[model samples]
Target: MMLPARGGPEPCGGNHGSGRDHSPARAMREPTAMTASPQPPSPQPPPSANPAATPARAAPPIRIAIIGTGTIAHTQHVPVIRAHAGFELVAGVNPTPVPWWAEATGGLKLFSSMDSLIRSGMSVDAVAICTPPATHYALAAQGLAAGWHVMLEKPPTPILSQAMDLHRLACAAGRTLMTSWHAACAPAIDPARQILASGGVRGMRVTWRENVRKWHPGADWFWKPGGHGVFDAGINALSIACAVMGEPLFVTGATLDIPAGAATPCTAQVRWATPSLPDGMEGIFDWTHRGIEVWDIAWTLGNGRRLLLSQGGGGLSLDGVAVTLRGTHEYECVYSRFERLVHDGASDIDYRPVALVEDILSAGQRRPADPSFRILP
Candidate 1:
């Protein structure tokens, strides 16, 4: 799940800023599987100025505009664009330009608004909407209609109807529209997907718990009706869920615990039924269990086989074997894939993932647990 207001380097919903999971070692892993059908072992990149900047492919990178120069924009998205050749770091938009340090991506023009950028002759080939979930629609629709390809950050938007409309418009315009499920782009997940596809799962149980107060601090926006707090991370699990299950799962039940006076759920316990697999398979997701947060996703197969995948969308500990990836690049990998699409046409929005989240939002309209979420001292 793409956590909201994750601005930069803040421990988001107990993710510890994802800084720990992605180590220098991650920078040393093998190339993604999609690059070559079955290439022979090749030399890896030695530590250089910026290994992450290495492009999956090289060319005149797409002139891309990153709308909303917020936290993730400066931290991950911009770096990915700069590191690769599939995209060019042409311009960015925000109330203010990214600071001098942010110029690492280089040759960036900061605009005050989308209209300003489009009118400035920046000639953007694509636009990555880095704005908050609530504002995604207005800006995305603007980009797509303007004839530039668009890549939207996760939770593509707070509204499903608007997202669906964006999808329609994208189709109508025949422009590449993508929603980056950053977790799904992890180069480390290839093995996990192999196991699931090999019929290793019979029944899977998933759990994600964390300490929000300490992590979020004064981020009061999370408790608002559309802030999408815990699910911000929870959706990462869902994307994995959709990847394994590979279809839209219907939400069977859910209990959202909201702060008493707040409009959004601080914690959520949800149940979803996956499409029939080898056996009748099902799963559960919990967004607010407190402490270091737990992401326990296990699969129980028939014939007495069981596999538990844990440690948050990172790796898989199959039956008992944990594959330690040399690298754990998420957004870098995502931007790599986007670069691929820009060079060769491709689309990567996981609707089934969003569909389930929408069901959860629609299913719960209850009172928040402590309402005092807003009155915090």
Candidate 2:
């Protein structure tokens, strides 16, 4: 199968340009004053994908809205937006009412739906969508239609075609559509990529095991059809693998251990086909491991050297020596790139990781496992 374009958010080690706009007026303008309405005018023919045709003038402290205000939004995105100097956390849109904690302390203007948020005429330059995998396409399309840059949570969407459509929509709208593959944002990834570039990969293996009950607690959606199950965490490793290899990776074969009643798998072993390592790069994902969560990827180079990324790519080691890596936290790194993309008027929607997941799930062999999960309401 042909790989999709690979131009998503750049690795954290690259230069994102000097964000040097000190425009006081753009900074001081409130969200309501940024745009008159959230509606786009009558659709013209899809515009050319050239961002330079009309240079984007988005100034720093970008007015951004959060779409879902769920677990990721509250813990990762909200804090990052509040802490980042280049973003202004304007408001949030959720179908359910805001929680008491958010209502009391977030100082966030919450709307029950996108239409409600639109009716309020609040303006924003971008939106970070932290909703479930299934809702991503519609919400992101809405964000693009409203003339806002979009940041989708990992997997982008459960379906590949939906993600492709969103990419086209973003390109035609001349807006940034970023996939929030935060695992690729780890500080050690770029260094690992640089080291891997020095030699060919002889072999690669990924072992990602965690107790889904312990990590996910009450997230019932995890076992549903659209909920990626084990691949939800497995794809993080793949993202890092793709980033470190500096190329796309394809799945050759896969074996899925699905629970008896669950729609998704609980464990998966996927074999990857790559040029350098034809019969190599195996990834094992299991959500039923009891002790010591393991998330690591090890590689044997053509030269006599070994590289390892442990703790979900947070730590790196080479030849029994720990290579010191430095950078901002992963989510912060993610927002920094979004800030740059918005300023540059560009979209970064890498399709390889999602494609890998879709392929593995769609084509993998399936076996029944003990149904140890209870799907919550």
Candidate 3:
């Protein structure tokens, strides 16, 4: 939504950005009580309506395929698709077996790769990309040009130009292209937005730090150039910031901590703008913390009743006031939204948030870590 244009990763094409594509094997395995579309899907909306949000349509299950079976896919994508009724889990192509959740599903088809799948002659309405950031551009572009709708994992592309290209393509194709940020659906976000929406004016503080070894032990994808390190965690905060303040928070001053011996930042202390926002914000983030570190949000309300959020916006307390959460239903909600988009023949692939991440990277200065980082057990 914000910048230049480009093509898919392999060669490039479509609205501007890279897309993923491939084909199918058997006929789409339609779930009971749903219509088999000749086409795709998107995320779902609430069963009931709020005056602020649009009423969502309950769609028949959408015909779908998945590319790149990685950790995120095993943990989220594959599992969510099978468990939810809004989709027809048609194809799974990863150069390997359907990891855990996908394996649980009885009889879905598999492909060697997107290119292989498409060449095989099976039909699919949409493709879900769960690959790392590095490959997103190409994979996504292929999918879009092939007339398939796309649903991407977070921080769609490393560069703004690529993200812009994808956004433009989706608009032109009149197909759905959603770069979903799963964390936004966290329970604390809704009420947090409500508090800000009520119109209180004030300044804020934010901190997000986690033990990298605990989260990414052997997987060293962090410092890999485009593999945006801390912001990987910070995107959740960014998603919340936009939901609360309404637009991209202008980055004022930032110094990212690259491990002295590595490339990406392990921590960052920065200043951000909330101009015209009734509530403003500032923050600090780190991934080198030793033990369980903090992931929190705080604000000074107009009345001075400071509101705070921890557990990454799950447990909230206002001036020491605590709010209990029920459960997280994000995956189900994601499929539900997909169902609505497909039934309505619409796509929601916006690059605003991804663009913002790109902007932060492009604008921010890089600073190396103190002692530098090395492997640990």
Candidate 4:
């Protein structure tokens, strides 16, 4: 059975600014695992009188652009990109004109389409695609083909093949392709992973519940085909689970509660095949729960102790006692990792979570349920 709600989602912590700073000191806060607290920025030395005494200048920030200026872009991506010292917000691509985006991006040159952005001869080092899942493959492919690093929002693509194709393209192009699983970047994730890696994971359960109206409001795309519906939020749990487990997840069976006239399920109950546990791992994903949203995972160790990761991997507790954690700034960690990947000419591509969702959807049984989602026209 699913556990009771602990608390609602906690706001991520990071530096807040217009993202106009070019100094490395203004970069995202880097936090270590477990009790490793974040260190303060180093103090800059005084300027030397002799020209030769001055140190070499730091590398210029990566010029990046945002595609699809919608809610996610406005709220999460834009703010993070702007606040990141390693990136400079240079341009945006959206068919519809957003009057406020000009000021938000510091009067960046906005293009009506990706084609226009590419045709304009703009210098861009990376592109963050925050568009819908169905559009991810195409946008990411275009970005990679253009010789720019690509950062894709969760569920990189609706299917596994498309995601793999993008990975191949990125590899051939030698560009960094990051499938951004923000939940995996949460503070408690690494700590939880460390504990699980040490062994003794007897049993685990995932309960992910949320009031869709509160978080997505009138976002009708979530109910459409390829929208992923409840899996959109549920995938975060899967990502956290796979990351912390340090192993691939296999779905034994699933039961889906799809709403009437909707192309996707509003709730899902999935069972996983875990070799260690007799009952294995069970997951409950619901989009209709009211009050405080719950995104929690609980594990029972063989020693009779309990390990809980709550608030979508933002907090960790053992035996009901909370542990002090840092690096709760998910997007900051995401951008910081992206910076490293680009610098190292490497890619971070993990499709396990998406594969798990696909497996559940493929082998799950479906039944009609009452509709609570407000499908915007």
Please provide, for model 4 over 111-201, each residue's C-alpha lDDT reduced to its tens digit, 9 standing for 90 to 100: 9999999999999999999888888999999998899999998878888889878877887888988878777777777678767767578
TM-score order of candidates, top first: 4, 2, 3, 1
Superior candidate under TM-score, 3 versus 4: 4
> How close is every model to the real structure, measured as TM-score?
0.77, 0.82, 0.79, 0.83
Question: How should the candidates be ordered by lDDT, best one leading?
Answer: 4, 2, 3, 1
Query: What are the per-residue Cα lDDT tens digits for candidate 2 across 1-377?
Result: 23334755532311121111221111211211011110010112111222222224456589998888766676667766776667889888888876643653367788888778777888688889988888889999998899889999887887788987887788778888888677777656666877887877888889999877766677767688777888887888877776678445678999988786688889999898786557777889988888977888898888969998877766789987998765335665577678777886766777667777888988899988766544432
Question: How much does candidate 1 score in TM-score?
Answer: 0.77
Output the lDDT of residue 129, model 2. Answer: 90
Model 4: residue 330 alpha-carbon error in angstroms: 0.5
Lowest lDDT 10-mer window, candidate 2? 33-42
Q: Per-model C-alpha lDDT, please?
A: 0.62, 0.71, 0.63, 0.74
Off by over 4 Å in 1: 1-58, 96-107, 213-217, 277-290, 324-328, 365-377
Candidate 3, 238: how far from true, in Å? Answer: 0.6
| Cα TM-score of candidate 2 | 0.82
Q: Which residues of candidate 4, in runs, are more than 4 Å off?
A: 1-29, 32-57, 371-377
lDDT of 4 at 18: 8
Which one is best on lDDT? 4
